[model samples]
Target: MAGGLTRYRHLSRSSSHRQALLRNLVTSLVKHEAIHTTWPKAKEAQRLAEKLITLAKRNNETARRKAQGILYTPNLLMSKLFGELRERYAERPGGYTRVLRTEPKDTYSQAPSALLEFVDSPKDVRFVMTAAAVARDLAEGREHTEITQKNVGKVTRYRAGGKGAFEDMVEKVRALDL
Candidate 1:
């Protein structure tokens, strides 16, 4: 019996498979800044991603070489890790990534889903512009328009075509009494 030998989840995978899985996940997370996967996988991947980010924060030759070895394809990912991501997380201490629970893609699968992403990632920027605002800016001959986070809800509403349409459809269905 391997008593008191607690370690990590085996994930029902062989050693090589598990390593490859984590390598791919970490690479994707570093490249895309976010990735969605099953909760267990995301949780496991988070460990590796955080470790890599911590290494990136060091911004030293040894750290860069270590990250390069862990990643599958080194060139692009290593550059990103040593360049943008290193600068992005330089101020912070740790906890580089966050795991957010998301709705499952299929109803039949009970496995929980999650989104693993870097905190304060560029993709998470709240600033959103409505179609109308973009059109107005273009028509005004404005070469550069500043997008601030003030009107996020307005952008969402506009993109969703407003709540009135749904309410009107609900009222029409109620009139049918079916």
Candidate 2:
């Protein structure tokens, strides 16, 4: 009866256990923007993270409620999703997250490892300044350094402060010609 439907990877978990695992993974991914795990687990989590981001892109109350249902903790994550995350990926068609295979810590283990992260996340936090910082710099007419480094594979730019900081920084930098 369930024929033709794609059976998702079980990751050797029961229905409830798997649901709980995915929920926690989604929450962690949203809050931290990145997580490291074994290949199979990362792949499964990536699937769910992308879906939640897509839902967030809608940015309506219904979409917010739907995402809240899937996420484990709703307040901060839901706000981030509906606000900054929604704006960041608005132009992108899909594929809001990425899975990068990584070297395993233990060479003896056979399981592959991977890093799952949102596409917009930054690699280094120190390299970025918050919107408030940018605003302060502009208001004070301070010299601001440009982002000279290029993003390597799986190494995206980091956002300082919290919500909307990265976007705000970019806008200020552009406006100030800095």
Candidate 3:
């Protein structure tokens, strides 16, 4: 069995506990649009999160019930998942979520940690920072630095129009600055 295909990590929990843990993680993700957790949990939850977003896109009764089964607060979060998140990712094909490596949440344990976030939400902090960078250059009458342009490109690629999205984010940042 050494070379046999291994499907998924056990995460050192019973099946029921694992299901509940993942459900809670996905639920929190839907509510807050992001979460920080150990790396393995993030990867496991990412798979479920992707499937749930696909279900949200379907926007049917069956899909709703299936999503409900996976969420802890289905009644409260269903709309966000099926409405805003649904439309956000509509133009795009897949990859509704992103996981980033981060400093360990528990220094004592030294477990690998990551941030799991829904892409293209209303207030994406990463996009905001990238927008701020571009806005600052524009204000100073300077050309877009290579790093700023790269950041903008990364922020806007998944968006329908990269320019529009980046511009919109810059506008939002400016508005906040006022």
Better of 1 and 2 by TM-score: 1
For model 1, the run of ten residues with the poorest summed lDDT: 125-134
Ranking of all candidate structures by their TM-score, best first: 3, 1, 2
List model 2 lDDT by residue over 128-160, tens digit each.
434445555566787654532232112233323
Score every model by TM-score: 0.66, 0.66, 0.82
Best-matching candidate per TM-score: 3
**Mind giving the per-residue lDDT tens digits that candidate 3 earns over 1-178?**
7888878878999999999999999999999999999999999999999999999999999999999999998889998999988988887799888898999999899999998998877556678878898777777789988887887777788776767877887888777767
TM-score of structure candidate 2: 0.66
Candidate whose lDDT is highest: 3
Relative to the true structure, candidate 3 reaches a TM of: 0.82
Q: Which regions of candidate 1 deviate over 4 angstroms?
A: 1-5, 125-178
Overall local distance difference test of candidate 3: 0.88
Q: Higher TM-score: candidate 1 or 3?
A: 3
Clashing pairs in 3: none
Once model 1 is optimally superposed onto the true structure by TM-score, how far is the C-alpha of residue 70 displaced, in angstroms?
A: 1.2
